[model samples]
Target: MGRLLLVVRLARRDLRRRKAEALLLLLAILAATTTLTLGLVVRAAASDPYGTTRAVTHGPDVVAVADEPGDPIARAAGVVAASGPFPVAPAKLAAAGRESDVQVVGRDPAPTAVDQPAVTRGSWVRDGGVVVEAAFAADFGLHVGDPVTVGGRSLRVVGLAVSAAMAPYPGSSCWVKAGCASGVAPGTVLPPGLLRTPGLIWLTRADTVELAADPVYLIDLKLADPSAATAFATVHNGTAATPKPGRVAQGRPSLFLQPWPEIQADATRLARDSQILLLIGAWLLALLAVAGLSVLVGGRMADQTRRVGLLKAVGGTPGLVAAVLLAEYLVVAVVAAAAGLVIGSLTAPLLVDDTAGLIGAAHPAMTWATIGLVLAVALVVAVVATLVPALRAARVSTVRSLADAPRPPRRVGWLIAASARLPVPLLLALRLAGRRPRRVVLATASIAVTVSGIYVLLILNRFLNGNGPYDAAQVRVLRHVLLVWTVILLALAAVNAIVITWATVLDNRHSAALARALGATPGDVTTALTAAQVLPALAGAVLGIPVGFVLFAALMVITDGDGDRVPQPPPGQLAAVVLAVVVAVAGLTAVPARLARTTLP
Candidate 1:
């Protein structure tokens, strides 16, 4: 207990002394944890509103539409109650100086036992007036008593309502007609953006009949087991091939059935995609965290060496020394994990679609499993980065540690010979870079990760801007995900670059002083330090272009599984991105390098 308390005191004191580095570590891990939390909670939160709406409206287990009127779809097996044989037809609606395609359904005046539309505003279906789906109405800024033109006939908006029988508004499935092309030759894929965004409206039977002469029969069924919807759809849609022989010979009405789960999934597809993007982004941020923390830990080892020696000289055991080193990061990791959980839980609901007309807001519950996983990841990052160095420092002989002398730079004959012919700045930069090749490699990798992320962002931005498979809301959600990813990546990379430069400056201070005695100016040394990082930045930026492409392609395969067409950014844009990264790295490292230069002997 004494040793443990001693370790805690030392760790806390060290953390207080190096608050900036500690904060950088916290921010790095926080980025990873927050994104991981979002990925885990978004899909769960998005479904809550849909479930609430389902309960409030008495939503159906399945909805079936037939080609002809008076079709007995309600007689299908497992159906205990049903609504409609209502007339459903496609028509055009114009309101607020804007026109849109819509599916108009004619419902009876009286409420039914199942699949009732819960009217939230004004009266239900009435003569010469129409009710709009709540989300669809909100989308177009329509309200009760607003004038709307349907199928070229003027009508008044009487009510706004919600139904769980289909997805809200534009995400609704094709009910009035087949929305996509029916057939095509093998290997000839259809172009995307085939489905037009459509809204839903409710009207009286006479008004619907007057609007469209051709109409389809719609039925919403309540099943004994709600989850049996898929089986019911298969049998009713005739894929099961279990229909009676006489009915098949008589050419029974063609029916299209949509299950409630399927509808719910459709409604939440944007959230799902956002979740996937965030999950992938979380992993990328983890890699950056590893890179940044490794460099930070490596640099701190030099500063802590004397402290380690003093502790050992005072009779502290190696295990105690290592514990002290590790404890500081563990405390920071726990704090970062807690911060991430709070921030992620609060921000998750903002990304979810609020189209489902539920009574309350979504509060994504933070489960213990999620917190444990995030905390574990944070600890792993800290341990993986600090363990080897801490153990190495702890194992050194007390006499050797007490010397506290800087390690001699390796003798590289060819590097020295080649660099001697260059200008002083370039020569000095080359030598400094060769002194710590591993740090150079880490800095390069950090820049590569950042640039690759930006590259992917450009491609996604282009895809979203162009007409693709996604709708407006989905595009907006993905853009937000990209924004989050870019911000985290840039911040981590900036921190890494500055940390690397400062570490280089400290490590080379004695050599730099000797150079000054040999007539090297402060400006030359500053340029050298900055140049060492810039050369790596250039390589990383170039290398990151391809890495970004591969990463994005892999992500697309994982999330969409060959379904989406992943677009590649233009070569010019990629080259420009690489150039910008190099320039940004030089700019970010300049301040620290200059600061280190000004303080040198």
Candidate 2:
């Protein structure tokens, strides 16, 4: 107990002393974990929005459609639940002095009672006047008793209501065909199209027997059973070769069953796209993590070694000493993980809400399971990062630690000597970077991570801008904006890498002098130093491809059925990105390398 408490106290002291470094590391971890968690949570939660909307609207499980007179699938699927052919009541509109088209949903209004859309403002359509959705009302500035024309007939807005069923307002925009409207026109209100106006009218079945407008599709059934919905739909959608033409092609219900599959497919597509953004965010976090930890560990290792010697002199066993050294990182990790989890929980709902709205569905609330998973991942990362550092501390000999002084690592001299033979500036840069392998590796990883992130982000931004086959020129613009942003970050990272390498070389002035005495030209020394950073940049780029792909795959919400095919990078674009990275890194060393090369020989 005494040893444990002492170790804890020592670790706490260490953390307090390096509060700034620890906080930076913690923040980096938190950011990565939060982004990853949010992505996963959003993907998981996407299903619920449509499910909730279905529940609220009492939507049918399967909606089979045929435009012709004799549609059979609707009647066939009606076995499990009450089903019927969908009725379309479209009409031209001239309401509130504005003219357009409207669709009046005509149904029995009673057979399917489970998922009825809730009335938000006024009562259901009981008689005389029509009930309008709050969204429709708000969009067109309509209120109860507002007069509107549909199908060349006039009607009064009797009540206002809202439904998950009607969340997607009438006449929503279509994917193809510009100026093709899917939703009801603004300033127009039409009910069942029974009252004729300037357009078509849908009549109550008893009011008029022969169908006025040809039904495009049939809504087979709406059930509370999601599993049944899927099973039935799978069988229906996967039916062996859709039936021959006129049999059920025109004004008749096709044997297709669309249920949760349609909704799930849509959500899944969005989820895939979102995953790409999440991936880019992850790589950014990883870069920050590697850079931050490298600095933290390298900067503090010497101090820690001395501290270990002191602990040994005080009769502290290696086990106790190791415990003390490891605890600080463990604590930081835990805190970061917790903070990330909280942040992820808070942010995921916003993502879900936005996505739901994008797909025209209700937003589902977040679940506790998501929070738990995020915390679990955080704890794992914390433990993994601290394991090696803690072990190294425990294994250091007591005598060496007690006599430890600020001395160059043994391998530095040989590396510096070998690096001197390289090209002028590159030689010096290599030696300088070679002095700290771990730091060099971290820098390399940082460059690679940043590149990976940028690439993924660019891909996603392009996707959002409508880059694929579905590109909508008017709404989306994927003009490499994310690529630009990523390049900016990479530039910063590359500059920092080069500057650090140059500074490391400069710090070893005595070594440089020794090398100069050993026949190293100033130009050669400069070139060697520059090589150190350039090599890492090269490595980062090479390693970035897979990481970029992984992120792309994870964030894609909707994609063509052809599978995950990365658009082949144009040779020009690839070359440009590489050239830009090289320029940024090389630029940083040019002045420093020149100065070193110009040194008095």
Candidate 3:
């Protein structure tokens, strides 16, 4: 206990002495874990939003539809409750000079036991007035008291509401007997020529009957065991193939049953897409976190040699010294993990797309599993960067550490011969990078991650901008996720570039001073430092293109049934992104390189 307390004190003092450096390390790890927490928490909490609509509306467990209005399957087994032999008819709805196909259902002023829509605005079902679905209303800019016509008859928009019966707007599939077709409706195949992603509306039974001389009916059922809904639906649907338009039943009419779980799955599909993007962003940030740690650790190792010498001279064991060094970062990592988890949880509901479609805020509880994963990530990053350096520092000879000696540069005949023919800056840049091959490798990886992220961003941005296949609301949800990912990726990349540049300058300070004394100008030193980073950025950007393509290809296969139909980003855009990355690296290196050239060297 005594020894452990001593190690803690040493670590705490070091952190206090270099508060800015400690904060930088904190930010590096926090960025990665926060994004990771966002992905995990959002995935867990997405279903709850649907549950909000379900709870307030007393959502049904099974929805059964038949061609005839005479209650057919309401008496089926496991049905504890039921609502509707509601009249439904497909009609052209014209509002604000635009028209769309809508499945208009008739409802009463009295709320039913199952699937009663909770009105968000104005009032509910009244004679000669229609309550537009919340999502549909928002999409068409329809407000309460606005005029809309159903099958050429005008009615006032009485309210906007949400239901647990079906998916929102474009995702809400057809219930009519004639069927519907829409590009956004994946896995839904019909006999063709019914409707295209129709919106939903509610009206009175008298208004629905006036719209269609003859109409079909829909029934909402609440099962005794909600979990057994799928089984109940399967048992009722039977072996009968769907009846054609205007066809009648042979014995039992083909009653199509849709369970609540399926509806929830459809509604939460946005969560899956957002999860994919955020998880990928989390990984990219993790990569940057590693690079940032390596750079900071390298600079600190150089600065602390004399301290290591003093500790050893005072009879401190190598293991004790190493523990003190490791403890510094481990403490910070734990704090960052906790902070990231809290921030991510608070920010999650804002990232959830289509807020208007679902009734409540989604705040997922932080599971033990999520906490463990994020803490593990933070600790791993710190260990990977600092372990070797800590061990080496502890093992260094007392005299060498106290003297603060730089490592002797390796003599390579081929490198010397080749660099002799180049400009002074290029020669210095090549030799400097050769001296710290590990740093160069890390810099290359950092830039590769950044460039690959940019490559994917361009493709995804183009896809979202084109607005293909998905509903406008769905697209907006996806776009919100993508936007979050893009912002974090770019922010971390910029920080990494600055960190790498500063580390390079610190590590090569002795060599740079030697060059200046040998008649090389400050401009030459600055140019050399900046160019070294540019070379790695250029190579990484090239390699990142193929990596980015591979990642995008995988996403296409996962998201689309026919991956070939998804458009590819143009080659010119990719080339432009690479060029931009290299230029940005050069720009980022300028300030650090200037300080080293004019002052430190």
Instruction: Report lDDT (CA) for all predictions.
Output: 0.81, 0.54, 0.83
Model 3 bad stretches (over 4 Å): 43-46, 67-75, 108-110, 177-192, 209-216, 231-255, 411-413, 469-478, 557-565, 599-601
Tell me the lDDT of candidate 3. Answer: 0.83
The sequence of per-residue lDDT tens digits that candidate 1 reaches over residues 252-325 is: 23687878888888777667878888887898888889888988888888788889999999999999889988
Candidate achieving the largest TM-score = 1
RMSD of each: 5.3, 8.2, 4.6
lDDT string for model 3 (277-331, tens) is: 8889998888888887887887897789999999889888899889989999999
Model 3 RMSD to the real structure?
A: 4.6
Residues 359-466, model 2: lDDT tens digits: 244333355675566666665555555566667777788988887754474467677678657665566566566667776777677767776676665554543443
Sort by TM-score, best first: 1, 3, 2
Greater-lDDT candidate between 1 and 2: 1
- Alpha carbon lDDT at 486, candidate 3: 78
Score residue 272 of candidate 1 by CA lDDT: 83
Output the worst ten-in-a-row residue range by lDDT, candidate 3.
Answer: 240-249
